[model samples]
Target: MKKIDLSKQEIEVVQEVLDHWQEQGLLEQSKVRELRENIDERGFEWKALARYAFWVALASLIFSVVSLFSDDTLVKFVERFYETPNLVFCIFFGALAAMFYVLGFRNKKKFPEKTFSNETLMLAGSFATAACIGFLGQVVDRNTNHFTILFLLSIIIYGVLSVKLQSKLIWVFTLVALGVWFATETAYHSDWGFRFWGMNYPLRFTIFGILLTVFALWGQPRISVLQPFQSTSYVVGLLYTMLALWCLSIFGNYSDFAAWTGVRQYEIFYWGLLGVILSLSLALYGMKVKDSVSRDIGFVFFLLNLYTRFVEYLWDNMNRTVFFLILAVSFWFVGRWSEKIWKKKSAY
Candidate 1:
């Protein structure tokens, strides 16, 4: 017999039904477990791989297109124009982006089941939007290097498009653009240096990430426009926060590696302390609020932070055999603990 695939929601509904039947004495608990075991609840791996492969293919296509212009003959031909107006390129790419977005939108509306094709169209539209923005930057004056302006423009454009189309993919671009704008705006105002309000890039981004996470949690419940994107925002915000915390653990408030290396480990240990504390705090808060996403992010990053410190501080002093042995033991313990929890849950 061929195996049938079930989505998470479908599996959940079936499980709930099984539980209801079991409660009514119509089914045995053991039978419920057996039925669930036959159904595949975690089919995310292949879907995730396919999505990644699609993006990789899209990137390769873009790279191939750019490579064509890298030919000597094509480059010289293009350089032949002393004043190649970038505005033309901007308009051209803008039109292409609009075309792709419209096509993608129409396809989504008419054939919503064609997810892969819809995503492909949206990806192409995003690339076209980037190209248009790049040319737009080139066409403008270069005196006041407010490059962040372009990022801000991208945010507005992407944000409007995302909301109008109710597209999480485009909203992701908007979030990225917002991050770029924040970094560039801070750097430009700080005279292109790392020190922003006495904080380094990672530290600043840490604060920004926390604020983003909070706003996502707070806004989604109240703002109807943002409800669809709540989960995306939460995940993205946690990623940013975790990454910044990782960087902060290594570099502290130093602007560059040279400066960080000059300082002793003990001197910058406070940053590491802060990182761990923040992770734990987030985890605890997650448990308090019953938010599994936040809790998982915190717990996972807490372990990562611990391992990072081990590698940074112990690699030079510890023996290779001892290091690997410690890692093996640690992972074994974690596995055993996880199995124990799983068994207990299964019993219940």
Candidate 2:
């Protein structure tokens, strides 16, 4: 019989459960022994190792290319490379992107188990595509900063490719491109001002994040092809929302550090309070709906807001030792509460 391999912690949990069942006369001792014989603790985490290896390999490849280009012998070649026409570079990178995408698609079909490798190829293709778009932008430079068009083009291209290839990696790039386009387009409309329509970057992005999250929750589920990407989109949207809110809590609507420094920390108290309230509300809603992702993010951001407030309001007035002690106690209490909740859930 094939053995089931599990992590040490998982094996321990299974053992404890089996022991409890036997003690309660729910499972036969012989049956428990048989089950135990078929289970083995995994000796290593090859999947994690493979993931790290792939990223390291990619970094090394990049470094090697950079080193080769920086060599003294390649000075003339490097200068000439820079002198090369934007259109030529654009075409070259475009071809490279096409080749990587084709290869990645072929690999996905032929060896479905090589998930990391296939995704890496797709990642390379995405980078190449971005380079191609950038060069294309340079090729059509008209002195005006119309580079926002390139980001829009990237969003369209990546969006199409993601759907066609059913690739989460490409979809992530599409979302990133969308964000870039949104930021640049807004800035352009505002004449590159620090504030757009009386809102700073953080405030503007906070609104953008809310809209993105709403779309992910309500709009994404309606599309059949997008169902697979729903969770990713939701998480990314939430991350954007939470991060922007954090920034808003710190910076409020201030466009510059100097402006922010002129106001007391209490002046931004409303923004922090808003973040805390929203996070708490989300946490409650997530718990009611049994949404783990929402619950985790909400709880984490709620704690973050509390910590930020603690520092902002009490750091100068309180002793360092007392402040750290309070933080430590709070963390310990939270951990104990979380453990109790985990136990209750496990019992159920």
Candidate 3:
């Protein structure tokens, strides 16, 4: 009895399908009319507007803070406050984080429909928590360059909070903190060198990503509390791996830019080849398994690799107009192919 509010395009698609069904004698005219009557065309997309407004508000808040600090009086006030003990900052931000979390939880419980606002509060809490941790680290600083411990602490704190709150936002911060810990820990062990056991940063993260992805696929599903985070973990792990692979394709295993430039492009072709093979393999595997996330990542990165290769191989050799023309045609073909697939799926 409830009318479904849909966009204009969606309404048209439903109408077209109803018309087709009536033409084929599959649906009665009266039934088609009734279905059409239940479809309400939306005049505006308020959800999208709200999402954009929230982002704009965040940007404006940042600009406002910048503008406030640009004033000489405010600048002097902050300069005087800079002499305050790190312990004070730590306690202040820790209290702020607690307040935000409490408010976020209260709102989530009382007004569950305010999804964006609830998450925004949680995000603010996460930032405040990070600031609290950072100041705590500074308070205990021994000039040992062992501040990587703070990240480890963050991983523990954020992980506990995420599970307690069932918050994907906090879980994302937990993952980010884990990555920071891993990277910094490795760098510290290697005495801040570019290579750790002959593996550069990208290579190191590629391995880390593989391990994370494997754990998400094999381990997370078995753990009851972790199941909710499985998709986020899987997606983030793949993004890390694919992005690292892209970087490897560009820079190879070289430690520095100078070394990379000295080596011929053909010498590093193997990395690119490996990236292409993995991308294609993932795409095919995703299609077979009906994993939409994997399929999309694989396909997108496959195209990215091709475009990068096109630029690397043909940029100097081809005419500027011809290069862009080929690029445009390729994108057009891709759009047409996607449309065909969408239409076929819709027909079903």
lDDT of 2: 0.91
lDDT of every predicted structure (CA atoms): 0.86, 0.91, 0.90
Model 3, residue pairs in steric clash: none
Model 3: per-residue Cα lDDT over 149-174, one tens digit each: 99999999999888888899899999
Winning model by lDDT = 2
Rank by lDDT, highest first. 2, 3, 1
For residues 202-312, could you state the per-residue lDDT of candidate 1 as single tens digits? 999989998888989897769888889989898889889888978988888889778777886767787788878888887888878988888888878888888888888
Candidate 2 — which residues are off by over 4 angstroms?
61-77
Tell me the lDDT of model 3 at 155. 97
**Model 1 segments beyond 4 Å from truth?**
1-53, 62-83, 284-290
Question: What ordering of candidates by TM-score runs from best to worst?
Answer: 3, 2, 1
**Residue-level lDDT for 36 in candidate 2:** 98
State in Å the error of residue 305, model 2.
1.2
Please say which candidate is ahead in lDDT: 1 or 3: 3
Off by over 4 Å in 3: 23-25, 64-73
Top candidate on TM-score is 3
At residue 200, give the lDDT of candidate 3.
Answer: 95
* Residue pairs whose backbone atoms clash in candidate 2: none
Write down the TM-score of every candidate. Answer: 0.83, 0.93, 0.94
